[model samples]
Target: MKMTKTPIKVRYQETDQMGVVYHANYLVWFEIGRTAFIESLGFNYHDMEQEGIVSPVIDAHMYFKQPIRYGQDAFVKTWIEEYDGLRTTYGYKIEDGEGNAAVTGSTKHVIVKKESFRPVSLRRVFPDWHQAYSDAYKSEE
Candidate 1:
């Protein structure tokens, strides 16, 4: 499986009074990683948005391994976990300076029409995008 890594600098504002990174920040990092992953596959999310199609997260989950403080080197590794035209699941791993996993998460999303927010089969809506996802699809063996 191919994974895309995106480096994220921990910012002071992203921390709480304890100086630990806020939990929500991991989700943001996941977004960054997911975007990079899509681009790495030669897909443009903005173009999809322009075409009145959007993929919205239906579920999100995270497992925190440790707290990350400001000024630490961190990066998110992302890969396509599963895709079956109707829904796509992306897996994420956030690592700290020493290459230890700080957080692991997954987000599931489904393509929908921007106007009505109605679900649409990716294969029926954007065949090329669907095929690309299928070509890179991954799942536990």
Candidate 2:
């Protein structure tokens, strides 16, 4: 699939007394990776929100492999793991400066109406975006 790699520097404030990056910070990095992936596809989440469409995470899974210390540079590789009309799963890998994976995870989200929070199909709201995801997934095969 189409993947986007984003470089991030671990800030001291994101760590605990032991200097290891907090587990919760990985979720934040996942969000950053997801946003960058969408933007890479020429889509702006801000515009989607303004249009009354919101994508919220419905499920998440993370596997920690290595500990990342503060002040180290890392990279998050993100891609569309799967996408149906109503839901999309984004996969991520956080790698340390040496390219060792620190964590791997996936988040599943569904697009909904901001007012009612009713689930909506991305294909109905954004056909091009939906098609782009399909194309990327197929290309991987």
Candidate 3:
């Protein structure tokens, strides 16, 4: 399976009064990881949006193992956890540059028509994209 790694330094602005990263910032980092994964496949999401296809998250989940503070660097590892006809799951791991994990999570998404919001199966409508996903497919199940 293919994976994308993104390194980010936690900034003070990303922290709350507690001095740890704000809970909401992890979601943003997840997005950054996902976007990097998408680009790794040689597809541009901005172009996809212009093509009238919108990939929206149907589900997002994360488990926090440790608190990350400002000035610490984290590496987000992202991979396609699974891809079926109409849905795709992306898995992520936020870690200290070493192997210790800070959080493990996944996001489920489906491509939909920008105007109608109806799900579109990439396998049939866009075989090339589906193939791209297949090459990196992963599943814990």
Candidate 4:
């Protein structure tokens, strides 16, 4: 499977008084990972929206395994877990500097028309991108 790893440096602001990363910071890291994954595929979310398409997350879930502290470097590994007609599921794993996993997560998103917010099949609108995602995933699309 093709995967992209985006490195994130945990900032002081990302931590609470306890010096551990705030709960919400993982969400931002997920977005960073997603963007890196998209860029790895030679596409960008901003450009996709300019092309009249927008993908919005419909479902998301994250599981925390270990605590990440400020000043620690984290690695977010992202891959396309599934891609069909209108939906794509992305999976992620975050690891600490020691290569120990800190979190595991996945997000499901659907492509829609930017103007109407109606579902659109990426296979029909952007066949190359769709095929790339499909080919990257191992399971049935």
Q: What tens digits encode model 3's per-residue C-alpha lDDT throughout 33-124?
A: 99998888888788878879999999999999998888778989999887886999999999876668898899999999999999888888
- Rank ordering of all candidates by lDDT, starting from the highest: 2, 1, 4, 3
- In the range 88-116, model 2's lDDT, one tens digit per residue, is 99999999999999999999999999999
Off by over 4 Å in 2: none
**Clash pairs (backbone) in predicted model 2:** none
Q: What is residue 112's positional error in candidate 3, in angstroms?
A: 0.4
What's the lDDT for all of these models? 0.91, 0.92, 0.87, 0.88
TM-score of each candidate? 0.94, 0.97, 0.93, 0.94
How far out, in Å, is residue 38 in model 4?
Answer: 1.2
Question: Which residue segments of model 1 deviate by more than 4 Å?
Answer: 138-141
How many residue pairs clash in all the candidates, one count each? 0, 0, 1, 0
Best by lDDT: 2
Quote model 3's TM-score: 0.93
Off by over 4 Å in 4: 139-141
lDDT of 2: 0.92
The window of 10 residues in a row where model 1 has the poorest summed lDDT is: 132-141
